[model samples]
Every structure is written in C-alpha cells, then in structure tokens.
Target: MSGGLARCSGSPDRDPGLQPERTRLAWRRTTLAVTVASVLAVRTALHGRAGSGELPAVACAILAWLGFVVVAHQRIRALSTPRPPLLTHRAALLTAICAALVAACGAALVG
Candidate 1:
C-alpha cells in the first residue's frame, strides 16, 4: 500500500465527495450536447438546397463531435486511476474551439 493506489483505504466504496463520478457525468453531458448540435447541423445541411456549400459546416460538426469523444475517453481513463489527474488545458482549448465551430455552423445555417 505504498504506491499511488494506496491513497484510498480500500473500503470498496467511492469517496463521499463523488468527484470522479461527477466529472464523468459532466463529460457525458458535454458529449451529448456536441452530438445533438452535430445532428442538427447535418439535418439542416440535408434540408437545404445549397448543395456542397453546407458541407463544410456539417464537416465541422462531425469533427467537433469526434473531438469531444476523444476528450471524454481521456477523461474517463484518467478517472480510473486512484489519483485522478486534473483536466488538461489543451482539452479545454479544444472544447472551446469545437463549441465555437458548432455555434458558427448554426449561425451560418440560420443566415
């Protein structure tokens, strides 16, 4: 019990604070939002008569969804350890970029 895993008392129960569970739930929510946006973008693109003009927006949405999936995977993996690592700045930046892209796509579809 001298290693990193020893941080816990082996009670077979999660911490009372439930930090890891909360973090994982938050990540799932984010992924769900991105997925919904991507689906909306694809639906809009399909309904429009712009042909290939809307493809870029759809592509951006797809990429954003994929990016979120990657982030979530990393987050879950990190949470599996006895001592969870802090969220990476790079992941935050990527999430922001993806959100912006999705917003822009929605705006473009509107106007």
Candidate 2:
C-alpha cells in the first residue's frame, strides 16, 4: 500500500529511495547561494563609491543569477521523474558559465 501517498506526476514507479529528493535539495541550496551572492553584489554596488565598471559588474551579477535560476529550475523538474535523464553538456556548460560570471562580478568588486 502507498499509505495515502500520491504518485509524483510522470513518475511511473513509486521510488522508495531518497536520491531524487536529495538531488532536488542540493539544487535548491545552490540556487539559494547564488541568490545571496547576487544580493550582496547589489548591496555593495549601492554602498560603495561609484566606479567605472561597478554598474556593469552588478548588472552581470543579476543576469547570471537569473540564468542559473532558469537552469536549476529545469534540472529540478527533470529530477521529479522516476528515471531522470542525464544532465546534458549544454546544461552543464550553461551552469558553469553563469557561475563564472557571478564570480567575476565578485572579483571585480573586490579589485
């Protein structure tokens, strides 16, 4: 008996394992970190004295966070299925590129 548990949409089998849950949580956590970084970048921009590249760095930070959110949301949705597909190279590359952009903004703010 499923004990009143509702089957997840598009998941044919009832998975007893927590692997999918764990993966979803990990994605959420990473997204949260990126969100925090983006907020910090904005705060720094507002408080710090104006610099030549500061506005661009803050804009990039916001755009990168948006990109990561989109990618993470898709990955999280895919993981909901019982047999989630493997991460595509395109998705992986996009995530990495977004992360690098955020990091570059941080470094630029510091310098």
Candidate 3:
C-alpha cells in the first residue's frame, strides 16, 4: 500500500481549467436545442398540409431528443470521474445520427 496513490479527497483544490464544467454546460445546451427542435417538429407534423408526410420527421425528432438525453447523462457521469472520459465511437455515432435526423426534419418542414 506504500505505492504512490492519491486517495479521493472529494473535489480537487486547484482549478483544473474548469473544462468539465464547460463540457457539462455544452451538453445541457445541446439537450435544450434538441428538445426545442423536437417540439417544433411535432408542431409542424400536427399542422403541416402534407398529412402523414411529416410524421416521419416528428418521429426522427423524438428519437433525436432521446439520443441527446442519453448523451447528456453519459457526459455528466463521465465528467464526475477523476479522469475525464474521451468521446467514444458510440457517442460520435449517436451524435451524427441525431444531427442527420434533425437535418432531415428541417428539410421535411421546408419541402
């Protein structure tokens, strides 16, 4: 047990660049944006003249919103650890899928 190992002393004393806090804030903002977009997509689906054509867009928006939520949770949990976690391939893939869904929803609204 004499090995040089730093015990968990709760929070760090010195500021670690506040990078984790910034990252948490960024995740929150992204979640908010996704929520707003999803709401808008639902509204468009309800009022659009294309009938069922906008339903897929709404579905995609909802899925994107859920994906964002999962990401936010993962991000928060990762930030809580002593060593910040790197962005995994799964996160990148989820983000890309969400972005594409949002873009599709926007295009559906326009066209």
Candidate with top lDDT is 2
- The lowest-lDDT stretch of 10 consecutive residues in candidate 1 is 1-10
Model 3, 1-111: lDDT tens per residue?
111112213456523565656676677788788788778777877877865567677777888878878877887667654557797898878877886788788788768
- Order of the predicted models by TM-score, top scorer first: 2, 1, 3
Pairs that clash in candidate 1: none
What TM-score fits each model?
Answer: 0.80, 0.85, 0.77
Candidate 3 stretches greater than 4 Å from native? 1-9
lDDT of 2 by residue, 1-111 (tens): 132224443356746775666677888999999899889888988888878889899999999999999999999888776667888999889988998999899899878
Determine the backbone clash count of candidate 2. 0
Report the C-alpha displacement of residue 45, candidate 3, in angstroms.
1.5
lDDT (0 to 1) per candidate: 0.75, 0.82, 0.71
- How well does candidate 1 match the true structure in TM-score terms? 0.80
Candidate 2 TM-score over all chains jointly:
0.85
Stronger candidate by TM-score (1 vs 3): 1
Candidate 1 Cα errors over 4 Å, as ranges: 1-14
